[model samples]
Target: MPSLGTDPHSVRQRVEAMEKVLERMFVIPGINKPVGLDVILDIIPGIGTISAAALGSYIAWEARNLGMSKWQIARMGGNIGFDMLLGLIPWIGAIPDLFFQSNTRNLRIIKRHLDKHHPHTKTIDVQPR
Candidate 1:
């Protein structure tokens, strides 16, 4: 694979962007207090859960584009599954997203996999040996 640094449209960037969206838009506000969107959109009968699941799926898709193996993709899917499944609960799931940070966890996994397999292709050397 070409160096991720040389490619501005690299999968790593896509994943990072998604992580940012999840953190800044959804997870962060949800944690500080009972945010309305996280509660309202999350509480709606069916559409809410579906919306969240779709957002999670987007993250998994980014993982797939990054050349992650099927196992890694499945793990990302599992995170979404957990988030959606638990998030359905009245108030429990929303609270967990603040702390669990599924997107952050998935990002970590993606970073680890890319760093391990494509160290030479990265722009930075933040990965620990």
Candidate 2:
């Protein structure tokens, strides 16, 4: 087992940051809902869908590196696949992308795993005003 000072904590931080960038970077005006690169990428069609899926996969890859079970990784992959399918819906893709945040879901899975296996890596989330 490796020391908690490096890998687990840093992995958690990177994964969480990626999730925030993908799913909740800023709030959309008027709608007042958070949006991020995931939704923004969905606006670009084929390349967008591919980019979103790849970014989402990066989180899953991190989970794998954390030694998460194959089942959990599969579920994360499924979420990304479903999101990709939704992203293939032409102009309407961004609408669904706004709600179906695969990166956020994957992040939740990673958090649960970390919380249980590497509890020392946990930290209180302080949102900036």
Candidate 3:
């Protein structure tokens, strides 16, 4: 399988797409709440929680591809872990997902790390006064 770190553009696009799905499809507009997938899938007993967990894992996978260090990966996993464990509760997990925005946060972290460490291939000259 191709690694995410090898292709930052594709990884970024995938993460952005997932965020859109969560924001647009899974969340409701009127009250500005996460009620679609969070509520319906979560109410489905075991599958709902598992599906959310899987979604979180997908984000983690992208983070790994983005060259996130081990520590960063662990932190990313922690976000999903909290989402899964707390979200398994009847009415609580949905609220957390609405507020947490784990994938979005992770994406930012990955971008920052990549920019700081790898940066772009092109080099810009700084003129000294």
Which candidate has the top score in TM-score? Answer: 2
Q: Could you say which candidate leads in lDDT?
A: 2
lDDT of 2 by residue, 19-53 (tens): 98899999988888889999899999899989989
**Native-to-model Cα distance after best TM-score fit, residue 20 in candidate 3, in Å:** 1.8
- lDDT (C-alpha) at residue 124 in model 1: 57
Query: What lDDT is reached at residue 86 by model 1?
Result: 68
Question: How would the candidate models be sorted by TM-score, starting from the highest?
Answer: 2, 3, 1
lDDT of 1 by residue, 59-106 (tens): 787778767899999888888788777678755566675656667678
TM-score of 1: 0.69
lDDT of 2: 0.89
For candidate 1, list the clashing residue pairs, or say none: none
TM-score of 3: 0.71
The global Cα lDDT (0 to 1) of model 3 is 0.64
Tens digits of per-residue lDDT for model 3, 33-91: 54335344555566787787687678788778766789999988887777677668776
Lowest lDDT block of 10, candidate 2: 1-10
TM-scores, in order shown?
Answer: 0.69, 0.91, 0.71
Which candidate do you rate higher for TM-score, 1 or 3?
A: 3
Number of clashes found in candidate 1: 0
